[model samples]
Target: MSALQEELILSSPYQEFEREEWKDLNGQFNLNLESTDIHSLHALNEPLNMKEIEEIYFPLAHLIELHIKNHDTIRDDSNSFFQRNQQKLPFIVGIAGSVAVGKSTTARVLTKVLSLLPHKPKVELVTTDGFLFSNKVLLEKNIMNRKGFPESYDTKKLLHFLSAIKSGIPQISVPMYSHLEYDILEDEEQKIIEPDILILEGINVLQVTSQKGQNNKVFVSDFFDFSIYVDALEKDIISWYVNRFESLRATAFQNPTSYFHKYADMSLLESREMATQIWNEINKPNLHDNILPTKYRADLILQKGSDHFVESIKVRKI
Candidate 1:
């Protein structure tokens, strides 16, 4: 091949755009979410406003719609070529980000918006937290302090659950987790019935864990038709974490049954100090060592500013 041809072929796979550039792609989708909807979906101290949703998330939802349609067509065409009768698989989308970076809120908003689409495809949201090992198991294993670490979860069960969904299983049940109680709920599960779209959101969703003692194994992203990573500076995320802790103190932590209820009575100064310490000791290490490393693996990235609005988007070229 000529030098010029080779150079063109090797152009960057990432095509990044400013927020406005991305928003103009579809030229404004009808803003279906309202104040009540935003209130319901927004996370504590997340700082999400409708302006950011209109300019950032709606466009993303539209792009995912296109991806879903393209995926369906490709499946149909391939199946026709082989004259095989098979169930259409679910379109899996993974949303990964650091703790308190608003990935959950992003997932919730997308689930609602996508459900409002013209096609109105059935959509469901699940978090990797649901697959985490119970606190009893963690205590037994002596990894209670390493709760958010990748090793803290039951990767085997998580793998099996997604495998069942992708294999077109009509019904699958995942374990449930309670943030207030801060433990996996015993004997309770979330039933996932064959949704057209599945939004799998969590801190470790993008992690590509190698299969131990095996060859040619797959990672979680292998099942995802599309994936997103929410991005922000480490400093900004730390600050946000502290703010969220303060907010939750007056809310979730105030409940007598809350695992963190002890923190409810702390002074504002003491609470902030404790939050900062925990971030540095636990969440910060997890983000840098495990979560942030998987950012580029996502099909798209939403880069958030310090104020928590999506300021830019990085799209991976086809």
Candidate 2:
């Protein structure tokens, strides 16, 4: 291991174990988890299995649990010292990565696994899509092609949402976006109430920006107790994006009201060309300009092989 990797392991509260060692460690948990394996979390069409989850994700969850416990203890100690009544903030985890890198899947799986922990209370997963500007706003700004760009999102709204969650607010409402419609829904919302853990996933969660003659403030990453970046080769991610686009074309895009319905009847060759064009013109540039630059800010990086399996992990030392 490199010095960085060694430092990460030493600083972390959880023990690092190989894939085969997970079964032995299973008894350590009081809860009966269906499968701690990483592969089980991948989409049904994607190839994944238990061993990947054990070696890669389980350890990360253990570390998160430890961090939550330590945070609670410190909060209690501080409250006693100050003799004040303040609710402890929820442990927030941020997941960031380029599109098609499977960050969403990672966020969902982490939420499930963390919630299954014996001591965990309520785990809520929120995606940055909820904070994106309405399609009308993007259209008005003539930024429809740049929809996924950082400027296309309402950063102020996202910050306020995180602030609300971090303040231990009793209830919060998050807007819902529909990928099929390619816009925020009219009357849909997600309600979160007093979560113990909040998982926030987005393409630019770790992005940093500064205004003229002022220090940077309120980055999405500032609210995170821990952050993860899912990584893969640019070519691999582009290929995955194309594949996913084709899959969506066959299913969701076929819906008459779908934003992409126009592409539903295209030939396979035409679809491939369209997918490649979109990636090269839109998604890839956004990744380079807004997303990939934030990789170093992640507390942990999950590197995936060409086959889409997480082959290695890099945890930054505290």
Global lDDT of model 1: 0.89
| Model 1: CA > 4 A from native | 1-11, 211-216
Q: In model 2, how large is the Cα lDDT of residue 301?
A: 83
Overall local distance difference test of candidate 2: 0.82
Q: Write the per-residue lDDT of candidate 2 for residues 8-80, one digit (tens) a residue.
A: 7677743333334443444454433465544456663356565555555667788778788889899999999
**lDDT for each candidate structure:** 0.89, 0.82
Q: Residues 41-69, candidate 1: write the lDDT tens digits.
A: 88888877788777887888899989998
Q: Which candidate number has the best lDDT? A: 1
